[model samples]
Every structure is written in C-alpha cells, then in structure tokens.
Target: MTQPVSKTSVLAGMTSRALVIAALVVIVAACLPMVLSSYQVGLATEVLIFGVLAMSIDILAGFAGRTSLGHGAIFGVSTYVVVYATGQAGLSPWAGFALGVLAATAVASVFALLAVRTSGVYFPLLTLALGMIVWGVCLRWTQVTGGENGMRADVRPAALMSHSAFYWAVLAGAVVVSFAMWRFVRSPFGLTLRGIRDSESRMRSLGYNVPLHLFIGFTVSGIFAGIAGGLYAMFNNFVSPSTVALAQSVEGVLMMIAGGVGTLFGAFVGAAAIIVLENIVSSYTERWLMVLGITFVLIMIFAPEGIIGKLRAITSRKVR
Candidate 1:
C-alpha cells in the first residue's frame, strides 16, 4: 500500500532536515538582540567564546585522545599576549591576535613534545602543572600583567559596532571555527589521529608517527584556543590571572564531557548549558561552584554519553 523510502531519498531528507535546523538557529540568534537587553547579549557573547574554547579541548580529548588539563594556561597566555602587544607595544589589535595565536601554537608544540612522552593520568598532571606555573607567572609578574588588578584594553575595532554586533561577531567566529574543526576531524589526518587514539602501538606498528600527529593536533588546538582568548579579551576589554585559573580549565573539560565527548554539537550545548546555569546559580549564592560540582557529578553518573550522544542513540533505536 505504501512505497519504501529509497536510500537517495532518505539522504536528501536528512540533508534538508539539517538545513532547516541550521536556518532556525540563525534566525533565532539574529532576532535575540531585538528582544534581549545589552547585558543579556553580552552574556551570550561570553558563552560563544567558551564554546570556541570547549571545541579546542574536544579536538584533543575527542579526536587526538590527549586529555589536557592546562588549556586555561594557553588561553591566558593568548589573552596576555594580545593585551601586551596591543595595549603596551602599540600594535594593531589584528596584529596582536595573529601574534597571540603564533605564541600559543609555539608553546603548545614545546609542551606537546614533552607531554607526548607521557600518557593517561601523567599527561593530565603534566598539563595541570604547566597551567599552575602560568597562573603563578601571571600573579607574580605584576609589572607587565598588572598582577591581580588585571589588564584592560580599549574598545574593539569598528567592525564590532554595537553590543549586538559584537555578539554576532563572536557567534560568527564560533561557527567558522566549529566548521573548520569539523572538517579537520573528518579528514584523512583525522582518521590517522583516531588510529593513534585507538592504539598507539598499532599505529607505530604500521609505521605511523604517533607522537608527531599528537603534537600537531595539540598545536592546532592551542591556536584555536588562542583565537578564542584574544576575542574574549577584546569583547570584555580586559584580561586577568583569574581568567587562566584551574577552575577555568576544569570548566573547559566539563563543557566537553557534558556536551558529548566526540560530538561537535555537544560542545556548544554544554557551553550554553553551563553558562546559563552559572548565571542563574550565582544570582542566588556565592557558593555556586558547589552546585556546579554536584551537577557535573550527576551528569557524569546519569548521562555519561552526553545529551547529543543520547539523542542519537534514541533516534537510531527508533529507526531500527
């Protein structure tokens, strides 16, 4: 009585569905500033910045299988570089951004070279130590960084005109970075990285340079994080040691885990959820970190695969 769906038809349907969803997202974001306050738009911009940071973490943790607990250091270093170059050295903001990315990438390469020698918990601890060292430098080096008082910048370039314009700029950056990351993960190099993740011994047996691949991945991820950090500094017109704290590193990990380890959409969702929840919780009490900790624990225990992964599982089961 009814015709079955052909493979081509099914694929087209899925593609159409994705386009519809993407269109809806853009429409909503474009209209949000009209209905929301400037403060709300500013908060949304922060969430987008975190989304970029989370995606960088995902590239290492999900694709390269290298879990870094020190991304906040890289992030902080980038922000400081931007502030120092533009604010102190009198370079253009664009030049400062490029230099920041280069610095972060170079640092990541060195760190990865040392870190790739270790594995599992040792790698994470190594990164944690690196992060703490950076934090200490930021705190103790008061002259350049302004120490605990932090550093501030003037307004961003004219491209970012209003609060809404800045929000859109951040969102556009997030989308571009996300797309590039998605493409990287779907490439042959990405497959090789996955091979390393699955089995370093096997990859080496096949004559693949496992450590080299990881180092490259780490460096690339750091560059992306640097871009996010530079944008954050510009958006807020400030940077501080607190921005690179251990808590911020943990937040990046939490965003990745909460969204779905290997899924790109998961990172965005997790960033949004965490930021929204933080804003709400902090309004009621200063001890909001306690609530966030408990929430993370519960999410780990109950929704271990994350919202996106779980949704996929449900959809797959239904289709079957």
Candidate 2:
C-alpha cells in the first residue's frame, strides 16, 4: 500500500533531517549552561572531551579500518605535557596547549614507524605494547607525573576563569574539530583512505603509498586525541597514570563501537551514552560496570552496527 521512494526524494529527506539535527544541537548548546546545574554542565564538558577522543579513534578504526589500543597513551602523554608546561615550567596556558598537542603527535608518529608495516592483530598488539610502555612511564616517572597522587596543573586563562566560560570554550572546540573531521572524511584524501580500507592491494597496485597513507591517518588521529588530552588536562587541572591506562584505551574503543563505527557523529553519541551511565548509574549502584557490559552485549545482539547504524538502517528501509 506504500509508494516507492525515488532516489531524489530520499536525498532531500536526508538533507532535511541533518539540518534539523544541526539546528537542535545549536539550540541545546545555547541553553545548556542556563538550564543545567554546575555539576551537570561539568559532566557535559567531560562528555565533549571524551567525544573528541572517541572521534579520533573512529577516524582510524572506522574509516581506515585500523584498530588502535594505544590511543590512551597518546592522550595521557599530551595531558602530562600540558601539565608540565603550565604547572612546572610556568608557561602560559596557550603555549602549554600547543606543546601538549605537539608532544602527542610526535609520540604517535614515532610509534607509527614500527606499526605502519603491520596490519590486523599485529598492529593492535604493537600499539598495545606501545601503550603499556607509556603507561609504565607515567607510573614510574614520579617526578614528572606525580605517580599515583598526580599533579594538579591549572591551565585556565583569565578569560576562562569560570566553569561556564570553560564549558563554552570546550563547546567551541568540539564544534570546530567535529566540522573539520566531517569535512576531512568527505574530502579526496578521505576517499583515498576508504579506498585503501576497501582494497589495500588494489590501491597499492594503483601506485598509492598504502603504508604512508595509513601512517599519516594514524598521526592525524593522534592530533585530535592530543587536543582532547590538552583540554582534559586544563579541565581536570591534574595528570596521572590513570589517564594513560589500558582501560582508558578500551573505553575509547567501546565508545566508538557503541555509537556507530565509521560515523563521526556516532562518536559523540557513544561518549554521551557511556559517560551518562558512569556518572548517573554509578550513583545508584556499585555494579554499574556490570550493567554497562550487559547493555553493550544487548546492543551488539540487536544492533551490531550501533545506535547510529541502526537508525541509518531504519531510515534506509523507510526510503526503500
């Protein structure tokens, strides 16, 4: 009894839906600080921070088809750099920010020297080892990272002295980074990466430097992870081994998978879902992790591609 949807009509519908979603997000951002409690707003800020981290991992795992378990090291390293730059060296917050991100990029590039040659389980294993090495450093290097106690590094500028102000800054950062990522994933370079993901040998036969492309993508992903880390350092005003732990790396991967792999917007969705449960559900029960694990299993059973992927599937079905 239903009419078939033409391709033109489906395209128009998708565009309209995207515009509505964008407008709604803008409205929420504008109203959040005024409506939410300080603690809630701070939690939201954390979501955005982790969203950036998850999105970075998504770029490689989703688009480039390379799963990395060492992202937390890259993230934690940046945070420590920012902390050291501002807290220990007495550098300006802005300068510390730059150095923090640069350090993360450098570390990721260095790791890529060994990782770029491998794929599949080998790449993840190498990255895991690299991550563990960084984690050990953060733990053993007491003078630099303050070991278990951690060092409180205040990197807030005069303009962002208040929590609300900092939240706005974070919101702006998330927006800019998300827009840039969205553009990058649609660009010719992104298309080439996808081609490599689909058929590495074919791309290589076409004279594409497959390893070089993957390496560059890996480094670029680290850049965003570093930015998230820098923001996290300033936001938390602290640095420690926990930031670089293997658990945090696993969390990033879980977020990406929960939201929807290969979809940038899904990264934020996944972060929100996970962070909300951590903050809210943990308050009610001590076994929140178990509950979360159960939820993840159910989601995978019903919607393996994730919430966004499932939604896309439904939309596609409707269009058909």
List TM-scores for all candidates, in order. 0.89, 0.89
Error of 1 at 61 (Å): 0.8
**Candidate 1 runs further than 4 Å off:** 1-20, 310-320
Question: Mind giving the per-residue lDDT tens digits that candidate 2 earns over 1-320?
Answer: 01111222343343666655665685577478899999988988898899999999999888888889999999999999999999999999999999999999999998887888998889889999999999998899897788888788778788997878888888878877776676677777888889988998999999999999888988988999999999999889888888998878878887888899898878989999889988778898998668767876888789879778888999999999
Model 2: how far residue 10 lies from native, Å: 24
Question: Which residue runs of candidate 2 sit more than 4 Å off their true CA positions?
Answer: 1-20, 286-302, 311-320
lDDT per prediction?
0.81, 0.85
Per-residue lDDT of candidate 1, residues 66-171 (tens digit): 8798888888788888888888888888898888778777777777888888888898999889888889999999999999999887637777868998887777
Each model's total of backbone clashes:
0, 0
* Cα TM-score of candidate 1: 0.89
Question: After aligning candidate 2 to the native by TM-score, how far in Å is the CA of 164 from where it should be?
Answer: 1.6
